[model samples]
Structure formats: structure tokens, C-alpha cells
Target: MMNFHIHSTWSDGLYTPEIIVREAIKKKMEKIGFADHYQTTKVSSISKKYLKMYLEDIKALRKKYGEIEIYAGIEVDFSPRTNIDELPDFEDFDFVLFEYVQDSLWDGYPLWMLLDLRKRIKPPVILAHNDLSRNFGATDIEAFLRVLEADNIGIELNTNLNYTKLGEFYYRLATPIFERVEEYNIPISIGSDMHENLELLDDVEDALSFIQEMHLEKNLKLFLKEVGERYER
Candidate 1:
């Protein structure tokens, strides 16, 4: 199993990266990533000054623990809390997660703004825990997904409780869009958005089931291919 979205002491999480890595190994996880908050006003985050240290920290853990693939990632709040214009070209990390895109409730920036910013970013980008059904319900599905494919952006199947409604996840609610996603080259990822809980390390079981139910194995493979390329480089 793999979980690409997680938090640690570098941001608002209770445990350190090492702690999370150790627990993941104990759970026999195949892959895990440390996606701490990056320069967001909404939470404790890693700034430019400590970015190198953060990457180095994850790198050291990768060497120390070969049982699981530990990737270095950052979660960027795509809202007023972040200065998108001054954002760095995150070529150093494995992948990036952009939260709250096109969500008015969080004052998130529009999709157009993110598309403009995508040109400067180097790593693979994934939309983090977004409620697509509500956020883009009015927009044309094909056109919206086309825009994402043009930019090579992926979507995350976040199984966090906070994003659930009536015991169904946001991704499950947007089943119609995902049913059509196979036609595009867009990637798909699964994340539990783990924060303070250690037992939730493998909570992505439901997400894995959803991937099979939707036959999105190809999209999942696309994301793994991107990550593999980054590692190969």
C-alpha cells in the first residue's frame, strides 16, 4: 500500500518524519511520503529558509530505511494564505499537493491562476482533498478535465474524515467525473491525509477499493511512473 499525503513536525503534525517513517515500516507499507505544509499562513509550515533541511531530513530517512519508499513532498495551500506568485520552482521534491483549488469557501485561487503557476513548477502536481462535485459542478466536465490533462495535473482520492459527507468521501461523490477520467491521461493518487494518528497509516484501504471499482489502475500507474522518473533522475 502507498500513501502520498502525510504531515509531520515540519508543519502542524504531532510526530516527526522519522516517527512516521518508522510506523509505516511497522505496518509494512510499500511506499509513503512526507507532505508537510509549505509556507502557508494557515498552519505551521516549512519556509524557504528551512526547505533544504526538510529535504535533507527525508533523504536521510530514505537511506536509513530501505524497506519502504519514503518521498519528500510539500502541501501548498492554494488560497490567500499562500503567495502563489513568489512560490519556488519545487524541482527538489518528489511531488506537490495543492489544496483548495477553485473552492470559494476557502478563498482558493481559480483554476486559471493554478494553470499559470504550473509552468514554473517542475514536479508532478496533485489536487489535494478537493470537493470537485461542488466546486466545478457548474463547469463543463470535459472542458475542466481537459484543462487538467493539458497541465498534467492529477487528483487525490483523500479518505480523510473531514472531507466526508453522509459517510461517503468527496471522491466517491464525484464518481461521475472519475468514471470519465479513464479517457484522459490524467493521473490518480490515494492519500489518507494522515495527521496526528498513527493507526491511520493504512487507512487508504477504501481508496484502494475505489480505484478497483472505477478501474483506475492505469491512472494510478501513470502517477507511479512520474514518481519513478523523478527518482531515476
Candidate 2:
């Protein structure tokens, strides 16, 4: 299975990058990624100066352990906590995750702002752990997804407990949006948002189940294709 969202010591997570990689291999995971925090405030995160070193650390692990596909990812807090104005191009990362987009509860920047920022970002971008039903439940679903498709933005099915509502995941709660996602060229990704928990390495099983139940396999493939293109470049 593939889990593209995770955290390690490069940010607020407890385990180091190598440790996370080793545990993922032990769990028989086919693919995984390190998506540590990249915020300016309210949390420990990767600053611009250490960004290159962070990518190199993951690069070394990819070479050391050829058993699994290791990807370098960053989770950008799309809120006031992040310095979006000075954000890097992130051309080196396999994929990018933007959390709290258009989330009023967190005072996140709106979708229009991210669209403007996307012009400068070359890598594939995914919306991380968002409550679409809460953020854009009133907006037209087709229009909302179309904007994402136009900008090449994907949505992440996160399995973190924090995102669950009365035992149902946020993605599950937003069934209306996901039900129609297949019709568009939008990509889909699954992640456990694992942090400080080794046993949760394979917690993405539920997310995988969601993809199959929703018939979003093609969307998943789209994301993999984007990641593969990065290798060719």
C-alpha cells in the first residue's frame, strides 16, 4: 500500500526519517513519504534554510533502502502560521500538501490565495486533512472541484484520529464531494498523518478502503503518475 503523509524529527514528529522508513518496510508498505511540517509559527517546522538538507536526508534513505519507494514531502500550513508570501518553489519535493485551505476555523488562507501561489509551485499539490463539508459545503461541488482540477490540486484522505467526527473520517463525512470526484481529472491520495506512533504505519487501510468503495482508483493513479513524472525530470 502507499501512504504519502507522515512526520519525523525534521519537524515536530518523534521518530527520525530512517526509523520511519525502516518501520514502513517492516509493515510491508510498498510506498511511503515524509511530509513534515513547514510552518512559520505555532509549531516546530522546516525552515527554508534547512529545506535542501531535509530533501537530501530523504534522498539518502531512498538509496539506502531500495526495498520501498521513499518520497520527500512537505506539509505547508495554509494559514497565518505560514509565510506563504516567501514560500519556496518546492521543485525538489515529490509532492506537496497544503493543510487548512479555506478553513475558517483555523483562519487559513482562501482557495483563491492558494491558486495564485500554485503558479509558482512546480510539484504536485494535495490538500491535506481538510473538512470539505465544513469549508465548502455550501459552494457548488462541481465548481469547487473544477477549480482544483484547473490548478492540478488533489485531495488527501487522511486517517488521523483528530480528523474523525464521531468515528467517521472527514472524507467519509464529505461524501457528496468525493462521489463526483472521479468525473474530473482531480488526483486522490491516502495518508495516515502518522506522528509519534509506529503502530499506525499501516493505518491507511481505511483510506484505501474508501478509495475502492468510491471507485477512485483512477484518481489515485493520476497522483502516482505525477510523482513518476518527477523522477523522469
Candidate 3:
């Protein structure tokens, strides 16, 4: 399995990059990524000065482990209070994930602001663990689709237990959007959002089940192909 959202000591995670790499290899994962936090508010965030060190560590892991793909990424918290100008350039990273986007938690920034931020960032922008049903389910679905398609932003199927509600995952609550994802040409990103455990690396079984139930093989393949093209992996 492939999981692009992971955390390490560079951020709030308990394990270091080398330890996480070893664990991922043990799990026989096809691909894994280290996406440490980069938010301005979070204490776990990696500062701009340490960005080079984080990238170098991931680069070293990439060279050391030829059997599995290691992607270097960062997870940003999309909050209204965050100063977008203070964030570093994202050209060096393979991808970037934004959390609390359009959600009640953290008083997330509006979708329009996120779109504006996307225009400035160079890497692919993905919404991490978004409460799609709560956020987009009540809004104008068509306009939302138009913005996602125009900006080429992807949404993630986060396999975190907290996302479960009423005996179903949050992504399951957003069937309307997933049903028409193909129509809008929007990509779907899957991740376990492993913060401290290497064993949880690529543990996206629930996400896989959701994709299968929704018959999103075509969409999944499209996302993979787009990522490959974007990162030249």
C-alpha cells in the first residue's frame, strides 16, 4: 500500500526519520512519505531554517532505501490566524497537505483564501483529513467542484479513528463529492496520517475499503499518475 501522510521527530512525531524508514521497509510498503507539520501556530511545526535539514534527511533516506519510495512533504494547518506570508517556499518539497481546511476546528481559513495560497505555492496542494460532509455537503457543490478543478487541489481520505462518526468514516459522509469527483477531474489522496507509530505506516485499510466501495479505481489511478508527473518519480 502507499501512504503519503506521515510524521517524524522533525515535527511532533515520536520517532526519527531513520527509524520511521526502517519501520516502513519492514511493513513492506510500496511507498511512504514523511510529511512533518509546517503550520505557523503548531509547536510541532518545522521552522523555515530547519527546512533544509528535513529535506536532506529525507533525501538521505531516499538514497539509502531503494526498495521503497520515500517522499518528502509537509502538512500545513489552514487557519485564519496563520500568516501565509511567513511560510517558506514549497518548491523543494514533493507535495504539501493542508489540515483543518474548511472545518469548524481551528477556525479554518475560507476556501477562497486557500485557493489564493495555492497560487503562490509550487507543490501540489491537498486537503488533509477534511470534514467533507460538514464543510462541502451544505454548500454549493457545483461551485466547490469548480474551484477544486480549477486549482487542481486534491482531497485526502484520512484513515484516522477520529474521522469515524456514527459507525462510518467522515469520507463516507461525503458521498456526493466522491460520486462526482471524476466529473470534476479532482484527485483523491489516501493516507493513514501516522504521527508516532511506524507500524501504522501505510495502514490505510479503511481508506482502501472506502475507495473500493465507491468504485474509485479510476480516480485512484488518476491521482497516482498525477503525483508521478508532478514529482517525476
lDDT of 2 by residue, 73-145 (tens): 9999999888888899998999999999999989999999999999999889999999999999999999999
State each model's CA lDDT, in order. 0.91, 0.91, 0.82
Full-model lDDT, candidate 3: 0.82
What shift in Å separates residue 189 of candidate 1 from its native position after superposition? 0.9
Question: For model 3, what is the error of residue 158's alpha carbon versus the real structure, in angstroms, after optimal superposition?
Answer: 0.3
Per-residue lDDT of 193 in model 1: 89
lDDT of 1 by residue, 81-175 (tens): 99787898888898999999999999999889999999889889999999999898888999999999999999999999999889999999999
Off by over 4 Å in 3: none
| Count of clashes, each model | 0, 0, 0
* Candidate 1 TM-score over all chains jointly: 0.98
Better of 2 and 3 by lDDT: 2
By lDDT: ranked, best first: 2, 1, 3
